[model samples]
Target: MDYRFSEQGGVTHVTLTGQLNFAANEDFQAIVERIAKIRGGKVVFDLATLTHIDSVGLGLLYIAHEELAAVGSSLSLLHPRDTVLRMLQLTEASETFDIIS
Candidate 1:
């Protein structure tokens, strides 16, 4: 997976592309670290280009959520593709995250 980070209106936006899996672990960790620095900040993950996600990818999202929550930050997921959305739903992660269309 590949990602780009940007800031808009005081919110951090991350655009994810390609596939999300174990291969993305290292890169995702960097994102988590960046998020750890923010206090009471808002983050949005744009998953429109993310075509696929596996269990490991789901776990990474959870880790990010936990990390951000611990630091008084919030995470939101935006425009997840159908397949990715299905996985999130199957795992009940849809309920855990704030997903925006």
Candidate 2:
């Protein structure tokens, strides 16, 4: 996966593209770690271009969420595709995560 990070309205936005699987491990973790290090910013994950995701990807997402929460920041995952969306829903994580189109 490829991600671009930007800032807007006091929120940090990350746009992720490509497949969110094991191949994306390193970069994904780097991005999440970078975001986690930043304090007091609302982190918005724009997953509109992500076509697929796996359990490892979800685990990274959970880590990101936990990191952000621990740092007193907030994280939001947005624009998930049907499969990824379903996975989140099936896991009941959609209730805790703010998913938007």
Candidate 3:
């Protein structure tokens, strides 16, 4: 998957495109670091351009969630595609994250 990072009004945003799978782990981790550095430590993952996600991708998202939570921060998923949204719901991952429509 491809991701772009930006910050606005104290919140960090990671805009994801393409498919989130095993190959995205390293890049995603780095993006998390950038997000963590933002003053409020609040992150939003924009998934509107994302097309698909596998188990590994879900794991990475969970990792990000736990990391931010541990630091007293938060992570939210934004505008996930139908397929990705279904996967999160099917795996019960949706409940673990804050999903924004």
lDDT of candidate 1 over 16-39, digit per residue (tens):
999989999999999889877988
Question: Per-residue lDDT for 15-67 in model 3, tens only?
Answer: 99998898988888897776666544788999999999999999999998887
Candidate number of the best TM-score: 1
In candidate 3, what residue range of length 10 has the lowest lDDT sum? Answer: 32-41
The top-ranked prediction according to lDDT is 1
Would you give me the overall lDDT of model 1?
Answer: 0.93
- Tens-digit per-residue lDDT, 1-101, candidate 2: 89999999889999999888889989988997898888877999998888888888888888888889998889999889888887888888876788886
User: lDDT for every model?
Assistant: 0.93, 0.87, 0.87
Q: Report the number of backbone clashes for model 3.
A: 0
Q: What are the runs in model 3 whose C-alpha is more than 4 Å off?
A: none
For every model shown, the clashing-pair count is 0, 0, 0
Give all TM-scores, in the order shown: 0.96, 0.92, 0.91
The C-alpha stretches of model 1 lying farther than 4 A from their native spots are none
